[model samples]
Target: MNAQAKPSLLAKFGDRYAVDPNKMFETLKATAFKQRDGSAPSNEQMMALLVVADQYRLNPFTREIYAFPDKQNGIVPVVGVDGWSRIINGHPEFDGMEFRYSDALVTPPGASAPSHEWVECVMYRKDRGRPIVVREYLDEVYRAPFKEGMKGPWQTHTKRFLRHKAMIQCARLAFGFVGIFDEDEAGRIAEQSERDMGAAQVVREQAKALPACPEEQIEKYAAVVESGQRPAEQIISMLQTRYELTPGQRSALLEVATTQGDQA
Candidate 1:
């Protein structure tokens, strides 16, 4: 067998970027080459870079930088650090990037929401002499409205808030992953814990009176409480579903629930 060769980034990308000569020639006939005229690169070029960068899982900002299209041949070729810094430092404005959609492409009816969504495909620009994916160009278009909010570290905070909310939701979901607990046992523990603190007998009496609710409803009630809603009805529903408890069981459950709260 032949010796193995070290893999370069391009080698890794391989056929993903390989262009078809016939298609490239056809694309060149459709659009004019204007890169050298100091005009900004087209949306098509910008989008190709965006799609490629996403495939590589690069930083979002770095991905955004790829949005700038080189004007030379309408092929937004990746310009190394020098081209990247020029845009970042405000030396030259990277303009002319825009997003567009084609209506001819169709999916099965009702498969998804009826909205104009971006589709990814490699496009050839005669000016650039290479095939760039068109999806990145579309991303640049959708991203234009939020350009102002993206400057500096604002995007970082946005990402952090999303991550924080996701973590909280995950934590809440984790409670259900463990085996369900018996409300009667939970109440007894609460009563004993309260009693250990030398609480009044009324508290123990209340704990014994509380109603038992289903675990799912308890989770919903917790959410309702967190949302600042009085979840009394939800609690009642839980009591009905979990324990098949009559009004008396609910009253008892409430009393015990209050005792448990006091212990907490």
Candidate 2:
């Protein structure tokens, strides 16, 4: 028998993560390529992911970079906060980055109520005469006029998400990753801005009214998933394709999946 060849990053990833690297990367590349130009993942595309994995130490199996559903069944690959940190901190050409958040208890005289919720990011490069600066505001992203009962990063995770938004935008300004973005941020903006910026209130109210899932459904979903006859993706794809689950239900199902997976 021929000696086994050394593992590429792809194969090594299989040992590092519980996920099947082949399937995980396959789905990711398919989604990444579809976002690129509406085409399937070519060998070149898969190689590109390998290069990226090395460059940023991202783990596809763990969703360091992931695919988010976009328009027309296409998908957008989003880099998580950890991935963003790796890219920025590992860049050889940069002196490093700096971020600052406003801490005033009250908003400026002309600014919106309560506080100035924003962050500023500065990317310092030795070759450049000056640092690249980017400042993003919660209001610029979440268009809802400042009022009570709004569901947004401003209320939910203001400082953290603010810094996140600013850092990602700053990364774009410092080194443009074409066709790549923190789509999770876009999703948050969409959620808070939908229906003339009123969806948040309705969503929260609806969430309060909805009862928990039937215990039998959770048990069954968990059992089938833990059995390993059908991979997690199979269950996820079937649910998304065959049934229309509300956001709350989807979240509940995901929680069950996580709990059961951990136990197994």
Candidate 3:
């Protein structure tokens, strides 16, 4: 493999790789992704897998990484636990890795239970002064209500998956290979993952659906506070009463109000 030349997908992994799109499509053809009904994973998905594999030096055949068609649009490339290991361990300056897990949750039978402790993965790189660390609980990894049919990681292997989640995060940080989004973070992003998003006290459902209040709205809210008129409370009352804003809408309005008032 020439340093200047792009490596071929059909060809084995080497230095300076770029996806051979045609070869990747061909590779996908032989997989379960190829429908017995003669359907196939979309071109977009195949290309996504190809680009990801090329950049990460992953081989789909070996299951270094693969697309899970069960999810929405089926474009999400799920890196195997091996994929995280490969990328983190394969780096030139790689040092080593470590992991830790908390005790299991003590919920009653068939009750909603969180993991005992958040799992942590730390990756050391020779060049960087400190290790890259990522911590996540079972809840952080899976946001959707655990379906009846699907095996929940919390039930099947919560600690294992959480460890894998942390490793994936550390690998992404170490390698800066972000061509694919972590499937864990795909459904929703969480700064604090413990809360029940479905609960009204946590947040209004409609408010969650609404996009962030626009920049202009925030600025306008700030200006109003600066004027010392139509206090935040009064404004919120109006939005709530007049517009009959859903919990989501009221939350958005309140957030903007608070943000602006804070500055004032």
* Superior candidate under lDDT, 1 versus 2: 2
TM-score of predicted structure 2: 0.49
Mind giving the per-residue lDDT tens digits that candidate 3 earns over 146-258? Answer: 56555554455555656777877777787686755454553333322324433554456554554544446545654675466767667656444334444664565567667
- Best of the candidates, TM-score: 3
Error of 1 at 143 (Å): 13
Superposed by TM-score, candidate 2 places the C-alpha of residue 8 at a distance from the truth, in angstroms, of: 8.7
Which candidate has the top score in lDDT? Answer: 2
Q: Quick one: ranking by lDDT, best first?
A: 2, 3, 1
- Judge candidate 1 against the unseen true structure and give its global Cα lDDT, from 0 to 1: 0.37
lDDT of 2 by residue, 70-105 (tens): 433434456778878877777776788898777754
Q: What stretches of model 2 exceed 4 Å from their correct place?
A: 1-57, 102-117, 143-154, 185-264
Would you list the C-alpha lDDT of every candidate in the order shown? 0.37, 0.63, 0.61
Stretches of candidate 3 off by over 4 Å are 1-24, 32-38, 69-74, 103-115, 142-145, 148-150, 181-264
Output the worst ten-in-a-row residue range by lDDT, candidate 3: 186-195
TM-score of each: 0.15, 0.49, 0.55
